[model samples]
Target chain A: MIAEIASVSFIGGLLSLDVSAWGQIMVSRPIVCGPLIGLLLGDLKTGLIIGVLLELIWINVISVGAAIPPDATIVAVTCTTLIILTESKLSLGSDFHGSYRMVVLALTMPLAEFFKTIDVKQRKLNARFVHYLDREILKGNLKAVGKVNNFSLFLVFLRGFLFSLVAISVGVYILPKLFSYLPYAMLVGLNFAYRLMPALGLAIAFNTFRGL
Target chain B: MQNLGFLYILVPVLDKLYPEKEKRIQSYRRHLEFFNSHPYFANVLVGIVARLEEEMAKEGEVKSEEISAVKMSMGGAFGGIGDSLFWGAWRPFTALVACVLVIIFLGKWEGAWLGPVIFLFLYNFLHFHTRFKGVLEGYEKKTKVVRLLKKMYYLRTIWSSHVVGLTLVLLTGLVVLFRDWEAIERLYFLAFFLSIILLNRWRISAARLLYLLIGISCVGGYIF
Candidate 1:
């Protein structure tokens, strides 16, 4: 379990880097990272389902200008990791198993906002790098430019790695325990909510075209 | 900030063009001024600036202030177009297609993985094309690259993508309903869908709606 958490956190760190610190490739998008994490954890199907759901839900949550949107990629990574890891721990063929994904998703969704706050702080800290480079360039230490840029990228990676590491570590310990305490009635409700999730996604996607 | 990024990208070019340390530092300082644009499209400005700097190095005709002016104006213009076309339209269109593919084929077929593959391929194809070609075109044609972008009919693509995305959303709702749902389940799905669409008019955010739906579900679960 410790090994699994560490490996997933490592990959999660790299994927989060794609968000802004490095490549802006759509790989950072939930649709990609969800399944990627799923495949790593040996549950591709759960990854795909969760990826598509999160992708649609946050489809319009783009970062325009300095306004940082909630970090959907982190949510997808954490949620998918939690579901796949916990699903294996619980005994199979249970009545509540089917709705487990929804419960995990509902609980984990707020992590997006939490991750964003951290992300905004990181960006604020990055301003110091610019001033540092400005000073170095004035000193004719042109080589410091690449070194500082690489260091900044490393910092971004470290931020992501440590964030996922802690989030997943704490989540793996807490989620299944909380899930076990849920009554059967609540499980059924979550099942219904799970099935209705696509509708919510579709409606939000439709809203993107609202004024068009 | 993008200013630092702009400086980083121009470093090699500046190094080559200005061998004298004082001149090179001046060129570096020049690029360190404010710069921001869509990441992909920013390459075009980089190319243009590189070319202008080369000319300034060789012939001493182009003024430094003119280069900054070009960066400011074109950065703003490209930022607007790139935001609308790529973020507003192209991304959603490609993402919708991938999602609908996932909804339709995830369980029934082994080809479910193709959704993400096709999405990456389709998106990056245009993305790389614009990124690489924009630089060359901007270097070759300079400001006339704007004319080239205008001829690409990006507005038409934006409009069509939105229309297609709307259709796909409706199609996904239908498929989800009839796929395996019972009558009661179907009714519940419809209720949630309509209420969400209606709630959207109140400008409720997606995150808020997410929590609200879950809250309702938990309570309804306890009752029914």
Candidate 2:
């Protein structure tokens, strides 16, 4: 369990870098990251389902201009990780697994906003690096250019790594316990919600084109 | 933050163009100024700036202020276009296509992995093309690159993607209805879809909607 958490966190850290710090490649998007994490945890189906769900839900959430949208990547990573890991740990019959997934997704959804707050704070801290580089460049220490950029990127990676490490560590421990405690009625409700999730995602995706 | 990235990209170019330490410092200072643009399209500006710097170094004809002006104007322009075309249109289109593919073939076929593969391949094909080509095109054509961007019919692309994306979304809803869902389930799915679309008009956040759905489901479960 510990090894699984650590490895997933490492990949989470790297993928989070693709969000904005290093590559703006769409790999950071939930569609890619979800399944990637899923494949790592040996659950491609859950990963694909969760990835497509999150991708559609947050399809319109883009960082345009100065507005930083919620960190969908973090939510997708943590949500998929929790579902796969916790589902494996639980002895719940296959019948209840669908409901279990919905419950995990619902609970994990808020992490995107939480991670966004942290992301904003990190970007604010990065401004200090710019000032540092300004000073170094003015001093004819041109080499600091690469150093500062690399250092900032490292911080971004470290932030994602540490966050995912702590998030998955805590989530893996708690989620299954919570799901186990839920009443049968709530589980059924979650199953319904789970089936309805794609509708929500599609609606949001449709709303994105409302302007056009 | 992007300023730092911009400076990092231009370092080797500056190092080569300005051998004198003092001149190199000036060039570095110029690039180290604030610069933010769409990451992929920024390469276009980078290429243009690199060419401008080379000219400034060799011929001393292009003024530093003109270079800054070009950076400011083009940065804003390219940022807008890139955001709309890539982030707004292209990403959603490719992702929706992948998602629909996943929904249609996930359990029924062994080709589910192809969804993400196709997504990555389709997206990065254009992404890398722009990233690699934009630089060369910008370097070769300079400001005339704007003319080339205009010719790409970005608006047409954006409009078509949105249309196709809508169709795919509808198609996905239909697929789920016929394949996995039963009679009551189909009605519930339609109701959820319609309500979600209507609720979206209220500008409710996705998270809130998710929670709301979960809350409602729990109540429905308890009652029925």
Candidate 3:
């Protein structure tokens, strides 16, 4: 549970900080984060594997204007993590691994979308926090800076823990049933996402480049 | 290499637009090398360089060649290009295309990891090599980048759109080939292409048509 909690906070903190707070790093991106979470859960291979698809597919899902990305990497990582944690591989002696993995992916995707909206809303509300940080910077107040950074990191992790918990929980509950029913439609939808989503990624990357 | 590829597309834009001293270009080239050496920071590094150049111009340390009017005449032109090429064309083309390839081949997820790392190699190689070429001769960098872009026969914006279109087409093809998806998607694609043809005839801007198509699809997809 602690590991799970830490994983979510690191992600949430990095995400919230990327475009909104310090804007210092985008390395915390899905390509980076997916492998990371996989390692944290003691499954580096799975993390690296999922990271690859999510990274390539959504490489251009960087921060832009008012628009928020569908967060492909987060979806990949969350889905993978949830699956590996709850379902056992051959070494783990769990017979339900195959079904669990598939069901988790199916369940975790919608959960990812739900959390994205929440993150976007949080970002919008962060305007005042941004102003406050700016003022503290202007005043050169170390105490203020330290306080804000610490508090923000805490809040970010708290949010991640809650989101991850709910997401994983819901995945465990109804995923197997739903997956059995709509595997066909879901496969089609994912294929659609994989191909078309890349184009969307290009639109994003191009939009960020300076006009010649 | 993807970053390097992007550099070929962009840094030449900077050199042609700025045309600064040998030292600046040399320093700039070094900076690009540093930027691309790290896999993820390539575009952001370019953006940082652009910002720094702008600041240098403001301080009267350097003169603006083409980017001079960036604030006034450029009208967010540089920003738009950066956004388009880095975020839009190079990143997505490098990324999503690979994603499509992975799924199209039905590769195992583990094997698909090469897509991004491959991009990294492509970008860095191109970035450093082009910079070195630029410092060796005047206009050399411009010639090289232009040639690269030309051979690709693709503008960044257009290329980005093409990636999107191709990926969508592939996805649709896969869906049809693999499983019985709702038959409605076929109708939806037909309607989308038809509307695009009709709208283009009326001379609606492509951007507007994009939004219109999306809007129409969402609404139509919902009802039908």
Candidate 4:
């Protein structure tokens, strides 16, 4: 149980730092961070590959001054997680191609983004949190704000991590049913994602040279 | 340093309150050195500090004299640097870079133990090689290794990141060329990248590039 708790908390700690401290590094990005974490949970290669797809399609996604761009972190992590689950299941014995799994997640990312707007509302608490910290610190009452920060960071981490865990778990559990509904385009989309990355990278470079 | 993590401030506070003054002070002043010793341990050290502080102040939780002084000092001195480096830059960059690389290279199901493994290895060993040299550590300062590392640190990291980005682009190109209509999709994405650079160089701004990028986005779908 401690392992589970630690897993949740680790996700929380990571999420806390994503916006607050670790924004400078791209480790928190789904491609890198998701795969790294996925490696821990096993199936790192799939995580890495899926991450590449998300990274390209949403290359410009970023939170800017006072604006929370969609939670690509969740979108990425959740999708990768599903791919891992589905791929492994198919690999084991199922007569299925797991590629459709990520396709579903890809389709759902916008929905996930819609739900994640709730995070921006929590952003409103930043000022009040700072005020609380100041008042407590001045009063020599470290407990008030320290606990607040700790708990706030915990919840911040928990919400995304849990949401992801549940979403992935549910998606993984139900993929066989969803497989029935998918069109041929799903396979093409997956195939496109597989190649889209290198194309974008070269384009970025070629364009850089041409303009220069 | 991408940014100093809030953990920086945490370390010094723990150092001040620590029952053992000497080790704590030494570790505090030479925190990076200690970190060079072990990242996981350093994280544990961070956890210890927070947990100890909580344990010490559980109930009515009157702040101790030493803890209060440390807190007062923390807000003014350590907190700023910690906030700036960790919050403002370093941690975000590190976290994002790490996560992004993992996602791209490894994916959600796949993984890259090497990346983090190399990170841990380099973090612990590279910065502290002089320790093995001991007395020579003083003399070896005569070499350019320190500056060399610093320079390499500057160039190699940026170089590597660009490589990752470039690789992504190339992958996208091959995929497009093969998967979709040969000529149209190829030319469209070609034009997309061309425009990205032109826009950036001309100061066309992202707002305007949106029109062009929208067309480019469609190219991916068209290729499919």
- Report interface Cα RMSD per prediction: 1.2, 1.2, 11.9, 9.3
lDDT of 4 at B111: 37
Kept native contacts, fraction for each prediction: 0.58, 0.70, 0.07, 0.10
| Per-model TM-score versus the true fold | 0.97, 0.97, 0.48, 0.51
DockQ agreement of candidate 2 with the native complex: 0.75
Per-residue error (Å), model 3, residue B6: 24
Candidate 1 local lDDT, B1-224, one digit each (tens) = 57777888899999999999999988987888878888889999999999999999999999999999999999988888777777777887888899999999988998898898888988888788889998899899998889888787556776677877888899888988898688766888898888888887788766788778777888999998
Candidate models: Cα lDDT each: 0.85, 0.86, 0.45, 0.45
Full ranking by DockQ: 2, 1, 4, 3
- How far residue B205's Cα lies from its native spot in candidate 2, in Å, is 1.4
**Measured with DockQ on alpha carbons, how good is candidate 3?**
0.11
Report the first chain's TM-score for all candidates: 0.95, 0.95, 0.60, 0.71
Q: List-wise, what DockQ does each model earn?
A: 0.72, 0.75, 0.11, 0.17
* Superposed model 4: Cα runs more than 4 Å off: A1-16, A19-26, A56-67, A88-102, A111-116, A134-140, A173-176, A185-193, A201-212, B1-224
DockQ of 4: 0.17
Clash counts for the predictions, in order:
0, 0, 38, 74
Ten consecutive residues with minimal summed lDDT in candidate 4 chain B?
B32-41
Weakest ten-residue segment in model 2 chain B by summed lDDT: B152-161
Report the C-alpha lDDT of model 4 over A34-78, residue by residue, as the tens digit.
566567567666666555545444444433323455666666666
Best candidate, lDDT: 2
